[model samples]
Target: MNLQKFSLEQLASFVQGKAVGQTEMQLDGLASLTQADAHKLAFVNADKYLDQANQSKAGALIVTEELRAHITSQQNFIVVENPYLAFAILTHVFEKKHTAQGIEATAQIHASAIISDTAYIGHYAVIGEHCVVGDETVIQSHCHIDDGVEIGKQCFIDSHVVLTGHCKLGNRVRIHANTVIGGEGFGFAPYKGKWHRIAQLGSVLIGNDVRIGSNCSIDRGALDDTIIEDGVILDNLVQIAHNVKVGANTAMAAKCGVAGSTTIGKNCIFAGAVGVVGHINIADNVTVTGMSMVTKSISEAGSYSSGTPMLESLHWKRAAVRFKQLADAPLTQMLKRLDHMQAQIESLESTFKLRK
Candidate 1:
């Protein structure tokens, strides 16, 4: 898709920034400072990148007002409060142009399935019996839509995704490639020296504008529904267990695992590799730092963190030894101090009574 280059003035207006250089300079797209050409725009957000910005071949640059003095090139510059955020907006504008349109005939759609003519189904896709795909939805190659699955309008399902039976996805839901939805929960019972499988009869219900990253797995509930509420963004390799409810607008980073029956509240952020235990409730607007182990419920909305950072082997061993002795050391010292204080108080009282 070939699009017209935007003038510096137009870009500044689009990004709500102030023009610092020639407004008539044109920029076709955005690129990194080191690789940007004369037709592209680049941004400098870090002090370390200021040198690269000066030497960049781009015709235009987006930068904060504080970095203006460091610029050596006579190219067009747009000054914004946050250069990174401005670049994010511009990148999204150009990304929309490269998207494909309309469904392919090679898609294997069932006769009983209902798909909107406006929806785009890519090559080698399988839409199972009685499935309903809504308008303007795009299902890419090698995707499997099982029986009775319902996907709402304007959804984007990437390649190799599996939507198991009875899964329901709401409008504008974006699922990345190789993600599995509505898989059976890990539930089993031990009976007479044999393991008996507990059937996972419930489905997964995903709400509108939820973005699930690549290779993520969401398990279906054991007896109740596994619910992902509206506007949730899950990063790659995240594992969401059965009967878990992720509240609206919560964003979880990569490798985070939420165990079964945990209810995560709205607008919460979990950093990479955070592990939350089962059957706990996390309050709204909670922020969990990277690699934290959440073992209990959090009733207040605040930042919580656990787990020690990596240290040198020798130092770590010493610290571990000290940690083990901490419990006994504190109690022993408290008892000795209490005995001395009681003896001193009794002696002072006896002396005062004799003097009186």
Candidate 2:
């Protein structure tokens, strides 16, 4: 792919940075300091990267004002308050080249469904009956969109993503590869030595600006709707059970398991590998640290953690022995002290009465 060139002056204004060197220099694309060619632009965000930035071959460099002295190559520079953020913005500009464009002939689109002409449907993608796909939405190869599913504008459904029947997605929602939406929840009843599955009647309703990572499974509710509110981000390998409600703007990291019927509040964050038990309510803005095992309801909006660290074998053995003896030691000491005090009081009282 041919690199798109942007003037240094235009880039500085786009990222809200200050230009120090030649503003007319053209930058082809974004690159790391070590990998940037003469036509590319690189950035240095920290002091540790100063050495690499100084020797970089890029046409222009984006860096903080404090690191201006490290630029020894007389190259163009875009000084900003936050170089890391500026670099991120520029990287996004370059990554747009990978976006899909036109629909493929092999795609199987339902005649009853409404798909915008601007949308791209990749090879072997299936859009079911009564489904609606908005403008500029891209359904990648091998994707399965079930009947009654509604996908909003500008959404990107990656390869192998399965959107089950009646799933609704809002605008700008991005689902990574192999993620399953609207799967049946683990609801079963044991009767007469055999297990009977409860019908999952509800569908998944996802809000706008949501990003679901790869291999995540979000189960539909058993009765009511399973809702993921706006701006929620879910990491890879996470399992959101049936009837669980995730509030708006909440971000959950990888491998987090939220059990059935749990109501997670708005803006809550769960670190990687956190386990939340079923039927609990978590208040808004709650933050759970990594590897925490949440067994009860959390009403407060703060960080919580639970897990014991490993200890040396000898020290742990000694601590265990003391812990076991703690209850008996206090009782034995209290009885002996009580007897001595009673004897002293009796002797004093008897002597005083006889003297009187």
TM-score against truth, every candidate: 0.85, 0.83
Error of 2 at 171 (Å): 0.7
Please list the C-alpha lDDT of all candidates, in the order they appear. 0.92, 0.91
189-255 in candidate 1: lDDT tens per residue?
9999998998999999999999999999999999899999999999999999999999999999999
Q: Candidate 2, residues 1-356: lDDT per residue as tens digits?
A: 67677889989988988876788888778889999988888889889988888788888888877788866775588989998899988887777644557779998988999989888899999989999999899999999999999999999999999999498999999999999999999999999999999999998999999999999999999998889999999999999999999999999999999999999999999999999999999999999999999999999999998875567998888877886786687877998899999999999999999999
Q: Looking at candidate 1, what is the lDDT of residue 246?
A: 99
lDDT of the structure predicted as candidate 2: 0.91
